[model samples]
Structures are given as structure tokens and as C-alpha cells.
Target: MSDTGGLFDGVLAAGPVAESVCDGAWVQAMLDFEAALAWASAAAGVIPEAAAVDIEKRCRAEYYDIAALGAAAVRIGNPAGPLVRELTASVAPEAAAYVHLGATSQDVLDTAAMLVTARALIALRAGLHACADRLAQLAEEHAGTVQAGRSLLQQAPPVTFGLTVAGWLGGVVAALDRIDVLRGERLAVQFGGAVGTLAALGDNGIPVLRGIAFRLGLAEPVLPWHTERSRIAEIAGALGQASGAVAKIARDITLLAQTELGEVFEQGPPGSGGSSTMPHKRNPVAAVLAAGSAAQAPGLVATLLSAAAHEHQRAAGSWHAEWRPLTELLRSTGSAVEWLCIALDRLRVDPARMRANLEASGGLLLAEQVAIGLVAAAQGAVGRQEATDLVAACCLRAGPDDLAELLAADEVIGKYLDRSRIDELLDPTGYLGSTAAFIQRAVQDWRSRSAGYR
Candidate 1:
């Protein structure tokens, strides 16, 4: 069944990760583990090959009743117990003995969780790379497009829009790298039997572990991690970092698309961003949803972290607490990534508006440049403090008047610089320090690192 119909699901959980963590997907992952375990047990000489083949045939998820399993899970504290029981009943009596041979409920469930996570990451990773590629394109396209750089919500100086997008790209690449490492090295199979030891499997336990890892395509853990939950915490932390990165870009887009700012907007077809009450409003809905989705991640990550304090050999409530939060965290961050892709895809920039807004400050944004120019023109006749004081006096007196014109008309300041020199210093584009180089570096880094993304 499709995971649809919720009011905010389309916006908050709209992606392949949503499907990958659904009930059916979880059931299938568990069944896949059961099938793989049977095959692996047979390979380790722990179960007959014919019995393993029979058990595998009955391990298909479609043969099980998910609703019944959910209800039965309450009795045994996990769905794996009910699932194994049903699988055993479905197979012949000879194969039934080997259905879940030497495996505990946590073994199947933990491995299943990893399988589900791996599948979900396949989509999340793709979406992130897509977002990174779009940012790279934006950075290259707007490398020379100058805009005001704001600090603490006020205009500071000139910076290219390309540089702004490049900053976003850098964060995304970092997040992607963290997630890549976790997916490759940490998502391992959990195979120890009850109490963290494969006592039932004895000498064949390691072979069975290797076989399961090979069949399921997951990393082989050195031992069972019934109580050790660092992998889950690591996944949560990486996803939290990714959500933060996506939220940062979304926040920037929303801010730039503000009514007063209007420097950038999410372009779309008619009726895309219409307001229910205000007809003229063109909202950045995608960015807003992306930010909203990301906003829910920290709390979910916290839940996972809290749940990571599992008791020895197994957890009472902590392990169970991780199930929903972990899946929801995946869903929320995945939604953020998907929404960000849509936002960047539809993003339209107004270079003219950016330039106009930069100039709206009336040269105040370039005050630092002006101060530096004065210090140079003084040629050490005036101390640095004196030049700074003079510029500060000019800025205060120049309110509503052009700063360059005000500086030019100042008697004390006019000795070192003229209107021509002042205007040149106030030029926004001329004051962009290393903006192009930064953009190039960001794009180059993305291109090089992304080449190795699998």
C-alpha cells in the first residue's frame, strides 16, 4: 500500500525515502533477512540445503499478513517473533526446524532495519547530489552577478550571488560526505543470537554471519550489537547535519524571496504560489516546506540519541523507541532534500534587483572599502584612527545624501580623495574580494568529490 493521504505527507514526507520506510517495505526487508539467513545457515552447514530452499520459498513478504504481525508483535515485543512463527508454519515440517535456526528476534529486526536504511539512502543520496549539481550550476551562472552581503540581517558589503550559492554547495558536499561514510562503513549486519552470543550456532556462527552479509549486501559486523547502538546514533547525527545544511539554503531562499528583498524567487506555472487570502502573493512554498521539514529533524535526532542508551545485552524500551524516530528522521530529512531540489530547480534570480538593492544602501555597504581607500590616500600623513574618525563623521552627516558625494564635499576628507576617487571606491563590483575564486573552488570540489559517489 502507498504511504499517502496525510494532509502534510505530500509536503513533509514526499520522496522515495518515505516509500522505503513504509510498513510494506519493512516487512519485505524482514522477509529478505529471513530468506538470506536460511541460505546463509545452509552454507555454514547449520541447516540442510533442501530445508533452506524450502524456507526461502516461504519467506516472501506477500505470503505474510502484516496487520496480523503488527498485532502479534505486542505479545513478543517485536514483529520478528510472529513473522518467524508464520514462516515456520508456511513451510514443510522438515524445513520448519531450520526456518530461523540459531537466530534471535533482534538479529532479524536489526538486520532488517539496516536493509531498510540502505534502500532509503539510495534515494536520499541521489537527491542530495542533484541539489549539489544545481547549486554548482547556479554558482557558475552567477559568478559575476554582484549582490549585497548581509550580516546579522543588515547589509554589509558586496558579494556575488555565485559566492552565496557556492557556500550552500560546500555545506551540502560536507553533509553528503558524512552520510557516504556512514552508509559504506557502518551499516553492518546484526547476527549475534540471544544475549549477544551465537551460542546456538557455535562453531558455524562466523560463517553464517559472513554468508548473511554477502547475501544481503550489508557489512559484516565483528559481533552482534544488541546493546551497542553507536551506528544508529551516527546515522542520526549525519542526517541531522544534512537537514541543517538543507535548511540553511532554504532559509536563504525564503529570505531573498521576501516582499522587500525580491532578489530571488521560485518560478513556476500559474497558480503555483498563490495565497488563499492575498491574490498577489507569490510565496516560496518549496523553500518554506523544505525548511519546515528540516525543522523537525533535530528533535527526532534527539530521540534516536536518547534511545541509543540501550541496556546491556538488549534494551527494554530504548530499542523500541528508536524504530519510529529513526524512520521519521529519515523521512523528514529526505523530504527536506527533495523539497530543496524543487526549490533550486524553480529558482529565478533578478541580478538587476540585487544590484538595485545593493545601491539602495547609498554606498553605506561599502563603508569598509571607503575607509581603506582613505587610509591609502592619506599616505601615512593621517593616522589610521584619524581616517576612520573622519569617515565615521562623514557617514553620520551623510544620512539621505550620497556617501561618495558627502565625502567629496567634506573639507578635511577632500584633501586626500576627490568625488571621482570616492565613487570608484564605492563601486560594489570592484570591492568583491576573491568571490570568483571561491565560487570556482566550490564547483571544482563538488565535481571532483561527486565523481566518486556510488
Candidate 2:
């Protein structure tokens, strides 16, 4: 019946977003816990060597204040207040003196959240890089792998599987780049007291604040951020963007794997699906989940944007609403990354299917190639319009059988090229331009940049 109990209950039942935030609690806890240790160690010197050791042990100890912490959070409409009260209470009175010393509620909360965000970002960056690498590998492995490239749910032209993979890789690489940039940007901390000043800590405020940041592995900001919510918004936005990228890839995969277009399929044993009536159906469950999670990211980002509109010094509504939703976005995004990685890793590529599909449209897909050939043969004798007209006429008049016969018999074309040569040019495999080369470039670039972290 208590407010905290209700809060805990709500958080417990939350979807992926809540789970991410919940799992992230440990990282946040570690930051705050260390802050207390540093503060205690710096102040009163009341924290002895043995007690320091004890504090470390106790801080490392696994404990949950879900109910109490949740209740406190509701009372103050924020987690920081409840978290400080509970943690301070848990420490021995001697060690407790150092707990939260010279630091306001926002100090521990924001920095701790940043620590968690940093870790999450690191993990996410790695996941995106991995996805990019997988895509590159797939592109490399199937560089000349031909398939029908579809547009508007209909076959359009001959395209290599490598080219398709490369496109996906491009998106992943871009997302990775964004993540890298975000990591380097200074994530400001919330250090100010009740207002926007370090008045609580008096003259010792700056030093003590720096000490807390140093001990907790966080960046020190010039001032407290009771009102400036940009960093938080930026972090949320980054996460949302990354999730959206992953979702787009998932959506593409799901579409490509549709039974009607079966050019590719999920690699593993099909996970369970709906009704007993549709016994043969094996849905694209992982892809769907990834896509759905991705679809939710934009809304989360919007919420973060809304949160950024805090009133001059503080705005409770905008700030408080950010905690849970942002947490959920982080969690869902992480899950989506994990799922996408698995899906990409085990993807089933069908070069033959690609080839067959490409060929299904007859040699019409090679209309462009024919036009080029005509232009070359004409040697400026015919304009582009004339060449295109000739090629179009040839394509429409010739079926697969006829096209093969004509290519063999026509002196102007056949004398210069053979059946195999024409097939090679018309084939998606040979026409993939620089797909393989691009994949290699991406792989090298990503590996070089991600070397330290990987």
C-alpha cells in the first residue's frame, strides 16, 4: 500500500526499458558507493584503513532497497533522494559521516546515471561495431553472390547479395561513429546544491566535488546541472538513434526473409510461433522483436527532448519522467543489439535463390547493360536516346531463349562478346561494382577505430 512499494511494483513490471535501467543499477550504485568512500576518506579522516576496507566490502555487498528506495523515490519524486537515504542509513555511523558528504542528491544521481550510461554506451558501441563487422564479413563472403534486388515488393534488377549486405554495413558503421563521438563528449554532472551553486560545500565544494568524480570514474563539471538537462537528453537521443538504426536493419531482414521472397532466411532452428492451425509457419520472431523495439525508440527520444525543457533551475515533471523511460530505452536498445547480432551471425544466405530470382525476370534486368554495350558499339554514331531505344527494343523482343540465340548470332554483338561473357556482365555477381572493396574498407576502418575497446 506504500508509495515506494507501488513504485517498485511498477518498475518490476516494466518492459525492456525498465529491465535495462534495473540492470544498470549496479553501475550507478558503484559510482555513488565510491563517492561516499572518497568523501569519507577526504573529510574527518574518520574512515580508518580497516573501516575503508569494511566499507568497500559492504559497498560491494549485494543488497536491494527496491521497496524502501522506491518509496523514498516517490516521496521526493526522484530516485536520488531515496537512494542516498537508504545507502547512508546502511553504512556504519563512522563511515556514514563520509557518505554523501558535500554532495547534493543530484550529484550522486546524475553522475551515477552517467556511469551507467557510459557503460551502456560502451556495450552498445561494441554491439554496433560487431553488427557492422558481421555485415562486412557477410559482404566479403558473398561479394559475387548474386540475387534479385527488389523494389516495391517486386523484382527490379540483378544485384549481388554483397551489395545488399554492404548497404546494411554502412548504416551500422554510421551508428558506431555516432556512438564513438558521444563517448568523447563530456557528460556533465549534477553537482550544484539546492539551487545552482556549490553553497552547501562552501569553500571546499569544488575540491570535494572533484574528488568524488575522480574516485567514481566520472568527469567533473564546472558547476552543478540542476537545470541543464542537455547531457541527459543527448545520451537519450544517442541511444534512441542507435536503436532506430538497428530496427531499420531488422525490418529489412524481416522483409527479405518473407516466404514469398525467400532470398534469405534466419539461420537457426525456427523459434516457436503462434497457432496450432499454422503448424508449418516459422515466423521471423527475432526480426520482429528487433523491429518493434526499434520502432519505440523515436518516442523515447521525444520524451527525452521534453525532459530537456526543465525550468530555469529545476522542473520536477520534466526531470522525473525521464528516469524510467530513459532506462527502458537503454535496456530495449541493448536487447535489440544483442538480438540483431545473433540474427546477423546466423543469417542464411542463398546465392542460388538470388540468382534464380534475378534470372526470373529474364534478361530484362540487363537492359541497362545492353544500352551501355550499344553506346560503346555505336562509338558516338548513336546518341544515348538512340542507344536506349535499341536496347529497350532488344530486351522487349528477346525472351531468355531468344536473347541467348541472338547474342550468339548477332555479328555486331556476338563478334565482340560470347555467351558466357554476356552472361557474366548480365549476372548480378559480376556487376556488383565495388561492393567487396567497400566491405574490406569498412572492416579495416571499424577494426582500427574499435581496436582498443574490442
Q: Pick the candidate with the highest TM-score.
A: 1
Return the lDDT, model 2, position 365: 74
Candidate 2 local lDDT, residue 44: 37
Error of 1 at 59 (Å): 2.1
Candidate 2 versus the native: TM-score?
0.82
Encode model 2's per-residue lDDT on 291-369: one tens digit a residue: 7666767887888888787887767687777776777678778777777886786678777776776787666777667
- The Cα error of candidate 1 at residue 254, in Å, is 0.5
CA lDDT of each prediction against the hidden true structure: 0.90, 0.66
**Native-vs-model 2 lDDT?**
0.66
TM values, all candidates = 0.97, 0.82
